[model samples]
Target: MAIAKTSPSIKYSFPPFVPDGARLIILGTLPGEESLRLQQYYAHPRNHFWPLIAALAGKRMPSSFAGRVALLQGNRWALWDVLEGAERIGSSDAAIRNPTPNAFGKFFSKYPDITSVAFNGQKAHDLFRRYVIKPGIVANDRLTAIDLPSSSPLHTIPFEEKLAVWHDRLAPYLPPKPQNRRAK
Candidate 1:
């Protein structure tokens, strides 16, 4: 019998997608399988994240990746993951281990305009509360932090229900809906 060799998979997070004049940072757990492969956040077509954002901000979900990012940045929003890297078998947040949190203290210092942290899911919130907050890298009093419902399709909630909760918590942070301009 021959033994096979296998190495542990260590996935790393991408650089934060923070644009200038950003006021709110939305953090998620590690990218899922499809997202990692696609090299974009919420790449899964089934994910509600982009649609929710579009509906909330009164904008259309753009077709291109750059457009999607610009939409958020234009709205004074930022996006990133809670961990710098982690050892996980797959996309399951529960299976995550050896989590290395991002350098939040440095991030906060560099981006003073960021006044709030909106967690994209419960997993991100728990991880930040444990690794980032417990280590004293960031003080809860320093920023308004809210745990929004997970935008994952696996969450099994109606889109409207999730949108309602998201709107309630994040409307203040999001830019106002665009006004329809009519032809003169």
Candidate 2:
């Protein structure tokens, strides 16, 4: 008898961390094994997501899951993946198969405030365009989508370079810094 070699199917665990005031959403292909095990998006230590986001917010990288969520929500950013579930070999997005995309129609309707979406990688952008955009779901003028480099550590580009691109692209969507008024 021959043994079958194939990746296992996994369902997304954490619901989209979409704060009420979220103006921008960061979308990934799917949570990797480390993220799934830790029950947090971008849980892999080597992943550049936390560092890049922290730099954008002018804060240190958070060491805890709650802190990370605070960073996202505080900045009016949301996090979610393109797929609801998929069969993947390891954490590689290239190995994904039988992908079931999340309900973007319902999600967009529920979160009407989400004006912009940034894809964390090419695969995410491809999946979203093929599954959601091609179907005429995200045709509204209020929403804009941008494709960004993957932060999975698999991409060897310098962190500073990636940060610069993210900062420049995302700056307009992020909330303005609060002005501190001094007592007259």
Candidate 3:
């Protein structure tokens, strides 16, 4: 896919933060308007991203931005988007254009500890194939990329179903929480 030319009316920026010491990097397309306005990742109220993450971790929903960041960091999860910047009319992934993709290689190089990478949805997976992954370029010992279900209300699947899929895909990476351990 060819990159679209940047538009004068469009303004975009990368997520303001990322988790340190992340073992897995999770990428998505550009943040929705709510996220941008809030200056936080997945801030849209209807978005299932945060709730799904909480379900997977078996924790109560985080009530604040700092709590959400802590939850991700505590789980060794890193968050960022595949597009460094893009022109778009709204939150729709299909509306993205002139995408200046993020330098994922740089992150992988710097955080050699990241062993697995997963995309938040089809848009990210497709973009990765078009821009990065399909190039046959590997960083820090050949990271594997997995396509995960979109944790968005736009997806028709029920919340429980989404949780099940995510739980299975993420199981290998998440260690058993203390609550799940049995007394020996």
Candidate 4:
């Protein structure tokens, strides 16, 4: 289905942390309260998204929102959400209701170079399946969905365990760091 332009009454913005010539697109369901408030992705202090990414990228942790945005963009990674708008009571993913999911097909059509799609958690994946994947907008071969552990503190998994799983799944997608390169 085509994504219609959001109505002016809708109070939302697509905070895409995208990079040019990105081969991968990482999707989430929607911005949590902190993200919306800060006008940035993964704004919650307890969210492991940035820290894990920094570790995987082998860079010092980004100190500012612009720094984080630059890191993702520099790596040729794109970030956006599946939901354009939703009735959310608080930041909990479980609290989302009547979601107006974004038009992913349109986005993909605009950027055919995106070779892989990653979901931040199961909610985004499920939304994609119900709205886009099952509808045949996205062919299974064209994209694969990897459900990473939720970065939310609510998940209660230890940080190390989370890092292990995320590191394993995300390592292949990360652009190689200079330190990892060897002289020929």
Which residue segments of model 4 deviate by more than 4 Å?
Answer: 1-13, 179-184
Clashing pairs in 1: none
lDDT of 4 by residue, 1-184 (tens): 9987533223244756567879888787788778888888889998888887777667788999888777787778899888888876678778777777687777888888987887887888888888777788778788867778777777788878878887787677888765675789
Q: Which stretches of candidate 3 lie over 4 Å from their true place?
A: 1-8, 16-20, 135-141, 179-184
For model 2, give the 10-residue run with minimal summed lDDT. Answer: 5-14
- Sort the predicted structures by TM-score, highest score first: 2, 1, 3, 4
Compose the digit string of candidate 1's lDDT tens values, residues 98-150. Answer: 99998999999999889899998899999999999988999878989988899
**What does each candidate score in C-alpha RMSD?**
2.8, 2.2, 5.2, 7.1
Report lDDT per candidate: 0.89, 0.86, 0.79, 0.78
Give the TM-score of each candidate: 0.90, 0.91, 0.86, 0.86
Worst 10 residues of 3 by lDDT: 7-16
Number of the top candidate by lDDT? 1
User: lDDT tens string, model 3, 89-120?
Assistant: 87888888788777777766788788788889
| Residue-level lDDT tens digits of model 2 in 1-184 | 9999775766563589998788789999989989998888999999999988888888888888898788888788989998988888789888888888888889889998887999998899999888888888777466798878889899889998898888888888767888999999
Which model scores highest in TM-score? Answer: 2
Candidate 3 or 1, higher lDDT: 1
Over the full model, what C-alpha lDDT does candidate 3 score relative to the true structure?
Answer: 0.79
What's the true lDDT of residue 71 in model 3? 76
TM-score attained by model 4: 0.86
